[model samples]
Target: MTMAQARGTTDGWPDGTFRNPVLPGFHPDPSVCRVGDDYYLVCSSFEYFPGVPIFHSRDLVHWEQIGNVLDRPGQLTLPPSTASSGGVYAPTLRHHDGRFWLIVTNCADGGGNLLVTAEDPAGPWSDPVRLPGVPGIDPDLTWDDEGDCWCTYAGIEQVRIDPRTGRTIGEPRRLWSGAPGAQAPEAPHLYRVGGYWYLLIAEGGTERGHAVSVARATAPGGPYEPCPANPVLTHRGTNRPIQNTGHADLVEAADGSWWLVLLGVRPGGGTPGWHVLGRETFLAPVTWVDGWPVVGGVEPVMAAPPWPARPTPQPPARDDFDAVGLHPRWVSVRSRPAESWSTTERPGWLTLRARGASMDERDVTFLGRRQQHPSCRVRTLVDPAGGRGGLVVRLDERHHHGVEVGDGEARVLVRIGSVLATVATRAVPAGPVRLRVDVLAPAPGDWHPGKEPDVLRFGVESADGTFDVLAELDGRYLSTEVAGGFTGRVIGMYAATGSVHFDWFDYQPEDGDGDPTPRDGGAI
Candidate 1:
C-alpha cells in the first residue's frame, strides 16, 4: 500500500494524543509563561513583520495565535541587511508586577537589545525601550524575592537593571558558561525554584549538537555549580526523530507539575537530516530528579501527557479576506504591513500597493502566512490591473517561487542565488486570474541531502473550469537547511510595479504520513 493508504486518513493530527511540535511551522525559540490558569507563549519572528507571534493555550497540546507584539512600524524596523534569519532573535516573555514584558534582540537595527510591555499581551504593546547595557541575544528578565530586578543574557552574564528605563545599576558579571566543553552557550533563563536560583542555558550551536544545561546558586548572582548530570535535556546524536532540540522555557501548572516548552526540527521522510518546516515548538514533561529538573524525551506524538487533559480551541483552515483588517496570522517582511497593504479599501478584498523593492530587497509588497505542513495547497485570486502580481511561495528574498500575471502574460518565476529564470510563460486571455501552488509531500527514502525533493506545482485556473500547469519546481530549495536560515516557507500574495487586489486566499494541508524521502540533487 502507498504511504497515504497506510495512514487511512489525510487529517494527520492524532486523536486523544498531542504531537511533539505543539506549534508547527516556523515557530522557533519558544518562551512560555503562566499567568493564573492560562499559559502564553512567544517565538522569534526574524525578519517577518508583525514580529514576535504570541500564542495562548489552556492546554499545552492546542494553541491559538492571539496576536503579534510588534505590529506597528514605530515599534519595529527591519533594515535591508536584516537577512532571512537576522531580525528579531530569541524573545523571552515574562509576567511580573501585573504586566507582561517581552525582551528581544533586533540584530537588523543598532538598538541591540530592547524591551516592550503591555497590559494585555493580545494588543497594542508599548514602544521598545532600548536596553543599551544588555549587549547580547536571547535576554531574560528575572526578579529576586526582594523585588530586585535582574537581566540575564546569553553571554551567561547578569546585571542589575531598572526594568522601566532599561538602565543598568552595575556592571554585568559573567556567570557559568554551561557544561565544560559545550559550545555556543545561550538562551539563558533564570528561575528561583525552592531554595536555589536555577539557571538554564542551551549550548551546542542550536543545531544537531544542541543541548540544554543547568546550574544553580544559592542566590540569583553568584558562583554557580553545574548540575551533576549536566545537559539535563538534549536529543543530539540520537535517532529520536526530533533533532536540534534546545532553547526551552519552564512553566508550572496549577496542579503543581512542571512542563517544558522548547524548539525542535522534524526531518522529512527518507531524509534523516533535512527539514523544511524549521524549528517548531515542542512540549515535554519535567520531573525533578535528585534536585535537578529532568526533561523527558519527546516522541513524534505523545499518546498521553502527564498533565490533565482539556479541550483545545480549533483554528480556521482558510482565510476568506472578508475581514476589515489583516488577520493576526498574516505577516509581512522587515516592516509593518499596514502601510502598504489594506483590507478596508476594498470590501472583501486585500489591496496591495506595489512597492519598488522586489523580493531581493527589504520592504517588498508581500503578505503571507507560514506554511505549517509538508503537503499543502495554497490558492489565491488576483486582479493585476496592468501591474505585476500573483501568489508566491517565499523562503526569503534570494530564494522563492511564484506565478505572476502581468505585462499581458502569465509566467512562473524561480530565483536561486543570483539566477532569476522563468520556468514557463504563456499569453493569457486577460481577465481576473486564479493562481495556485500545490506542494506535494516527498516520498519515503527519496530525499537526497543538499537537494530539494518536495515538489511544488504551479498552475492557473482557466475560464473553462480547468487548470493549466505553469511549472513544477523542487520544493527542497526552500528548505531551511539549503536556504541557510531559521525560517520555513511562507505562501502568500505579492505585487510588483503597480497596484494589485487579491480577492481571497485559501490554504489547506494534507495529513502527515509516509517515511518520506529527501530531494534529488539537481540544478535549478
Candidate 2:
C-alpha cells in the first residue's frame, strides 16, 4: 500500500493536551533529530529483523514509521541463535552536514558498534561501518565546532572518531558517571546547546529507579559540572502511572522551543504492577534553567507543544498481506530469510514455511508486530490444513500464549518458562478458520482479589462471526516483569509444521471506553 493509504488520520485534541507515549508499544531508547521543519526518530529493535524502526513527524507528537534503518539482510544480520533482546541496542540518529548519520550497537555476532549514513531518513541506508575500536553499547555521535566527531557511549566514555571510516582518532576517556551512588549509568548522549557542551546520561539502572542526569563542560572532554537538580526527570518512588523513565534525547523545534523524547513504561493490574507493552516513547517539554536544561514531568496527559498540532497518519490497524512486501510494523524473529516467507506465493495471502517445529524453537518461522496498545484485539484467518500453525502472543520463546490449529482440533497453548501446556482445545470442521486473541482491562467488578494487568482471551470465531473464548489467561504472564526481557509482547502468526497461509490479520485497539476503533478498511 502507498504511504498515505498505509496511515490512518487522527483528530487533534481540542483541550491542547496530548497523550503520553507519543510512540507506543515496544519503542524503547528513543533518539530523535530535527531537519528543518521535519523530525526523525529511531528506536532499538532487539532480536527482531529489520532493526531500528525510523519515524517522521512535523510536531513530534504524531509519528508515522517511515521505514527500518536496517531493512536489507546485509545491513543487519541477527543470527538465529541470538538471544532475545540481544541483537540491536540503543541507536542515536543525528543530522549533520547535509547527511543523516546513525550510530548503534549490535550485541550479537561480535558486531560491536557501527555507523550508517542515509541522505533521507526513510532510506536506502548505506551498509554499516563497524567501529571495531569503540567498545560498549548505546553509542552517540556529535560534532564539535572544528568539525571533530565525538563518540559517547554507555560507560560514560568519549572518543574522537572519523565518521566516514569509523576509525578512532584518540583513546577513549571517561566522563562524568552520573549520580554518586547511582547504579548502571548508561545511555549517554552529547549535545552542544549553546556556550557549553551538555552530556546527558541515564543512571540508576533501567528499572524502577531509572532516571535522566545531565552535566555540562566547556569542552567536549573536560572538567564538567553536574546539573544541581541532578536527575532532571524520573518517576521512581511516585504514585505516577508512568515509571522507569530515562534514556532521553533532546531536539529543538523550528520555533526555538525545546522538547525531549524519552522511554517510559505504564504498569497495570495489582501490587508490583506489570508492564506488558514495554518501554514506550514519551514526549516532555524542556526549558533552560540557569544554563542547564530542566525536563518537565512525564504524565499520562500533558500539555501539547506551543505550535499547532501536526498529526501524522497512524498505521492501519489491519494488514491485508496483499502488498509484495510486509508492512514496516510486521517483524520476524531473529532472521527472516526470503525462503521462509512469501506474499507472492499465495497472491493476497501471507505464506510461511515452517523452519522449526514450534514457537519454542528459536528458528521458528514467525512474523509479528509489537502489541502497541494496552488493550487490543488481534484476529487472523488461517488455513492450517497445509500444516500446524496459528496466532500467538509472545514475550520471547519462553513466555507466550497462543492458539494453534491442526489435526481437526484448535488448541490454546501457554508457555511460561519451563512449563508448556495446551490449556484448551476444540474440534473444528475442515477449511479456513478464524483465530482471535483479545487483551482487555478487567472491569471494577471483575477485580475480585488479586487482579492481573489485563485479561487475554484466546479462541476461534464461529460461522456466525461470534468469538468463542476457549481460555482466558492473565495478561501479566505475557508482561516484561514475568518474561524478564528488555522487550514486550509481540502478537503474530507462526508455522509449527508445514506451511501456513494467513488470509489477513487484524489488530483493533480499544480506547478507554472499551470501544474498539474502527478497522483499517471498515470491514473485511
- What tens-digit string does per-residue lDDT give for candidate 2 at 11-69? 55446677778888999999999999999999999999889999999888889899999
TM-score of 1: 0.92
Q: 366, model 2: CA deviation in Å?
A: 0.8
TM-score for each predicted model, relative to the true structure: 0.92, 0.95
Predictions: Cα RMSD each = 3.6, 4.4
Query: Candidate 2 regions off by >4 Å?
Result: 1-12, 444-449, 513-524
Flag regions of model 1 displaced more than 4 Å: 1-15, 269-272, 306-309, 337-339, 444-453, 463-466, 514-524
lDDT of 1 at 144: 93
Best by lDDT: 2
Query: Candidate 2 versus the native: TM-score?
Result: 0.95
lDDT of 2 at 287: 97
Clashes of 1: 15
